[model samples]
Target: MPRLGLNPDHLALAGAELADESGFEAVTISRVARRVGVQPASLYSHVDGSADLRDRVAMLVLGEMADAATSAIAGRSGRDALGAFADSYRDYAHRHPGRYEASHRRTSPSPRTVDEGRRHSTLSAALLRGYAVPEPEHVHAIRLLGSTIHGFVTLEFTGGFAHSAPAAEVSWDRIVDALDHLLRTWPTSSTDV
Candidate 1:
C-alpha cells in the first residue's frame, strides 16, 4: 500500500527541493525516500524509478518557468516584452540552479511531459507575435530565442563568465538588446531556395 501522505506529486516536490539543494543529480529514488524519511521501496508506489522522479522534477521546473515567463510578459510588448521574457528565464535560473538543471534533463515522452514542454514553446511564440515575425519563420525565431536564453543561462550558471572582465550582467543586457534588434529587423529570404 502507498504511504498515507505520500504521492507522486509529493515525491516529485521533495525531489525538486532536493535537486535545488543538492543538485539535480542528487535526486534519486533512494535519496528522495531518505529525504522523506522512508525506505527506498516506499518510493516505488509513487515513482517508477529515478527517471520518473527526474521527469516529474522536469515538469515541475518547466511549469514554474512558464508561470514566471507568463507573468513577466503580461501587459508588455516589443522590446519590453522581449526583455521581460529573457529576464524571466535568467532570473529563474539564478534562483533555482538545481531545478534549472533538472529542467534540462532528457525524458521519454508522456502526455504530461508533452504538454508541459509546449508551455515554453507557446509562451515564446506569443512573445514573438509582438514582433510580427513571419509565420513560416516562427520556428527559426523560437529556436533562436530559446538557444540564446538557454546558452546564456547555462554558461552563466556554470561559471563560464566568472573569470571574465565586465560583469555578466552587462553582457546579458547587451545580448537582450541585440536580440530585440534582431527580432525587430529579422531578415526575410529574398529568394525561395
Candidate 2:
C-alpha cells in the first residue's frame, strides 16, 4: 500500500529541493528517499524510477516558469512583453539553477507533461502577437525567440560571460532590443532581403 501522507507531489517537491541544493544529477530515488526520510522502495509507489523523478522535477519547474512568464508578460506588449518574457527565464534560472537544469530534461510523454511543455510555446506565440511578424513566419519567429533567450540564459548561467567586459545584463538588454527591432521589421519574404 502507498504510504499515508506521502503523495507524489510530496516526493516531487522533495526531489526538486534536493535538485536545487545538490544539482539535478544528484536527484535519485535513494537520495530523495533519504532526504524525505523514507526507504528507497517507498518511492516506487509514487515514481517509477530515477527518470520519473527527474521528469516530475522537470514538470514542476516548467509549470513554475510558465506561470512566471505568463504573469511577467501580462498587461505588456511588444518590446515590453519581449523583455519581460526574457527576464522571466533569466530570473528563474538564476533563482533555481538545479530545477532550471531539470527543466531541460527529456520528460516522459505523459499528457500532463506534454501540455505543460506546450504552455511555453503558447506563451511565446502570445508574446509574438504584439510584433508585426507574418503569420506564416510565426514558427520561425518562435524558434528564433526561444533559441536566443535560451542560449543567452544558458550561457549566462554557466559563466560563459564571466570574462566579458559588459555585464550579461547589458548584452541581454541589447539582445532583446535587437529582437524587438527584428520582429518589428521582419522580412515578409526572401525576396525582400
TM-score of each: 0.96, 0.95
lDDT of model 2, residue 80: 92
What are the lDDT figures for the candidates, one per model? Answer: 0.92, 0.90
- Per-residue CA lDDT of model 1 for 1-193, tens digit only, reads 9999999989989998998899999999999999999999999988899999999999989999999999999999999999999999989998898999998988879998899888988998999899988877788899999999999999987799999889999999999999999999988785734
Residues 1-193, model 2: lDDT tens digits:
8889788888888888998899999999999999988899999998899998888889998999999999999999999999999999989988998998998898889898879989998998898889967777888899998899889888887799999789988999999999999999987776533
Q: State the local distance difference test value for candidate 1.
A: 0.92
Question: For candidate 1, what is the TM-score?
Answer: 0.96
Q: Find the 10 residues in a row with the least total lDDT in model 2.
A: 184-193
Candidate 1 backbone overlaps, count: 0
